[model samples]
Target: MPIAGPWIQLAVKPTAFDSDDRGTWLIFDGLLQAAGAALLIAGIATSGGDEEPALSILPSAGPHHAGLSLAGRF
Candidate 1:
């Protein structure tokens, strides 16, 4: 819906937008937004489920250093 703002503006009051190629740019913007949404939906719908995700963190210390180790699975 947010992506339709420009289209609505152009339709209701074409003179509001001052861009030289407002229609062209709006078309491009709509296409890009649609493509991005499609990709996002595809990614979420097809995410892998083969492994149970896991994560662990371990603290480590040495003579002159201290750090944490991170391990994970997705």
Candidate 2:
């Protein structure tokens, strides 16, 4: 029953490494988590801002052979 109480408390807590000290590993963990979230958001936000290249495909046939050409513009 004692072990079960601690397990239940751990499961109910929001952060596993919660601490009262400001200068603890929890602060660093929070900073790292925020930085990662910011980077992810920035990447997602800027991903669609770039213009895609225009593509062209040309096909040609001659008396003896056939060929295809591909071109693109940024």
Candidate 3:
């Protein structure tokens, strides 16, 4: 079978709708990259390799209550 590379890849900034030239693009791209990096770092620091959001609070009583549980992504 033929290989398909990056069927969908992380976007390079200067989104598809942008109209900036290369010079302006680098600055915004850098800013975008920095923001993404910071977000990644924050996510990693919080979840380590387990990316997930957990219930912050649990109800004391309820027939449908599941209490608190892990909700993972990837």
Candidate 4:
């Protein structure tokens, strides 16, 4: 099938860039993946040892007045 060629190419020589558009896309995809991985690592590293429960605040607005509600698992 027509789709087989591209799949074969990707598998045979993984680093090969078949065309300029594909090359650019590969580069951008790699950058985004790296960024996501870095953020994940940073988040894990920065989380303190304290096992304190997480907290969150939600704000609601209606036709009359607005109010803030706090939620947590202390």
Task: Give each model's clash number.
Answer: 0, 0, 0, 0
Cα lDDT of model 1 by residue, 4-73, tens digit: 7667766765565565887777778777877888887886667487766678998988999999989876
Higher-ranked by TM-score: 1 or 3: 1
lDDT (Cα) of model 3: 0.51
Per-residue lDDT over 1-74 for candidate 2, one digit per residue giving the tens place of the 0 to 100 score? 32244345445557645455433544465566667778877865664546764689999789999999888654
> Which digits, one per residue and each the tens of the lDDT, describe model 4 over residues 16-50?
55555764554566566667778877876675677
lDDT of 1: 0.75
Off by over 4 Å in 1: 15-19, 52-74
Q: C-alpha displacement of 57 in model 4, angstroms?
A: 26
Give model 2's TM-score versus the native structure.
0.35
Summarize candidate 3's per-residue lDDT along 11-52 as a digit string, tens digits.
344356545465465556566766777888786577646446
TM-scores of the candidates are 0.52, 0.35, 0.36, 0.42
| Residue 38 Cα positional deviation in candidate 2, in Å, after optimal superposition | 0.2
Off by over 4 Å in 2: 1-23, 48-74
Model 4, residue 39: displacement in angstroms?
A: 0.1
1 against 2, candidate with superior TM-score: 1
User: Could you give me the TM-score of model 4 versus the true structure?
Assistant: 0.42
Model 4 weakest 10-residue run by lDDT? 1-10
